[model samples]
Target: MTAPLAPPGLHTTSLDLGGRTALVTGAAGGIGRACALRLAGAGAKVRAVDRDAEGLAALADRARGLAGTVEPHVLDLTDLDAAELAAAGTDVLVNNAGLQLVRPVEEFPPDVFHTVLTVMVEAPFRLIRGALPHMYGQGWGRIVNVSSVHGLRASAFKSAYVTAKHGLEGLSKTVALEGAPHGVTSNCVAPAYVRTPLVEQQLTDQARAHGIPEERVLSEVLLTDSAVKRLIEPEEVAEAVAYLCAPQASFMTGTSLVLDGGWTAH
Candidate 1:
C-alpha cells in the first residue's frame, strides 16, 4: 500500500454521482475498489463486478459504510453475455479488470498472452459495445479505462501487458471519437506503480526474477523510474476516475490522464 501524497488540509470536494448507475469491473481489488467506493460515496448506485465471489461480497459490505449501495456480481469478463448483463442500464462504466505477466518474450506462453489480451482489450471493447445503446439513448455516459504507464513506454519482460495496454488506449480514443457525438465520452487513466496486491505480487516475482532484495526491487526498480520516487496511491487514481465521470468533465474525452508522478516527463 502506498502512502497518500496529497498535501495536508488540501481536499478536493467530491462530485455527486447520485442517481447514476455505474458498473465497475474488477471492483473486488485495488484501484477498482477505490473507484467503486468513490463513485458510490458520491451517491451512484454501484454494481461491483469481480470473479472472486467472496471479495465481491466484502466490497459490497464495505460500500454500505460509505452510504452507497453496491451490488456484487461474480462473472468472468471474457463472457460477452455476462458483460452485457452487468452493463445493462449503467450510466458509467469503469474498465479496471486486467492481468499482468512478466516473462521474456521468447518464453511467454501463448495461452497466457491471449488471455491477457482477451481481458484487457477484448473484454472492455465488448463492454463498450454492449453499453453504448443505453448511453446513447440517455445522451450521457462515461467510460474510464484504467491503463498503465507501460502503455506509453516499453519495459523488459512485459510484452503482452504492454501490447494490451497500448491497444486499450487506442480503443479508448476510437470510442471517444465515436461517442462524442452522442454525449458519451471515453478516457483512460494511466498510473505508475500502484501499491496493490497485484503489484506486491509483481514485486515478489520481479525480485526473484532479478535476484534482488524486495526493498531494492521497489526502490531501485519501481521508484527509480518515477520522478516522485514513490508508488501512486489507488485512491488518487480513483479520485481521477470519479472526476472524469462528473458533468463538469463532459468536455474531456479521448485523452490519457497520465498520473505517473512525472515518470513520462522525461
Candidate 2:
C-alpha cells in the first residue's frame, strides 16, 4: 500500500541557501554522502570531504545536476590542522567522520581508541574553531554533529565509539552556548543503527566480539533495544541534518534530534 501523502502545507520544505557553502566530512559515503547531496540540492556550494578520493569523485559526478555544486575535498581528519583549514569559510559544518571497533575496553587497542577520539571529537572542535571566524563575521552559521544512539546510552563492546560520541555531545552543547550570541547554532543528530557501511562493519565485528554468528547479530544485538525492528536510512538522518540547518530551526540549538526508533525509550 502507498503511504498517504501530507497536505501541501504539511509537506517538508527546502530552505534557500543559494549563496551558502556547506562542508560535510565523511562525504565519500553513507550519511555524509546523503547530507552533501541534500545541501547541494538546496543550492549550497558543498565541500564534500573524505580521505576516499575515488568515492568523492563519484559523489561529485552524481551531484552534477544539483541546484548548486559539490566539490570533493580529500583529507584525513586526523590531520587536525588540515581539517581545520579545510573547514574555513563554510556556513554549514557537518562533522560526520567516524570509525569503530567492537571490543571490550580492556581488550580494545589503545592506539585505535586515540584515533577514534581524535577524529570524532578533536577534529570537530578544530573545524568549528576554523569555521567560527567566518561565521561570526557573517553573523550566521550551522554546526551539525552526526552522533549516534551510543552518544546517549551505551553497549558493552563499542567503548571507543561510545566514548567519542558522548564527548561530541558535550562539545556540541558547549559550542551552542558560545555561538548563540553570534547567530551561530550547534546541535547533534543522534541516530541508531543507520544502514551505513560503518554499521555493516559493526555487525560483522560485533558477531565476532560477542561469539555469535553474523546473521544473529542484527536481531540479537543491534536491534534488541529498538522498539522498531529496522535500521534507519542514511537519507532520513540527512533530512534531519538539513532541517537543523534551516531558518525555521534558528531557535533550536544545543539539542539532540534523535532518530533511535525508540531505543532510548527504554
Q: lDDT of all the models against the reference?
A: 0.87, 0.92
Cα lDDT of model 2 by residue, 238-265, tens digit: 8899899998999999999999989999
Q: Which of the numbered candidates is closest to the native, going by highest TM-score?
A: 2
Q: Model 2, stretches more than 4 Å misplaced?
A: 1-12
Candidate 1 on 62-139: residue-level lDDT in tens?
Answer: 888775689998889888677876787889999999888878889889999999999999989888888899999999
Residue 10, candidate 1: C-alpha displacement in angstroms = 6.5
Worst 10 residues of 1 by lDDT: 1-10
Displacement of the residue 196 alpha carbon in candidate 1, Å: 0.6
TM agreement with the true structure for every prediction:
0.95, 0.95
Clashing residue pairs, backbone N/CA/C < 3 A, model 1: none
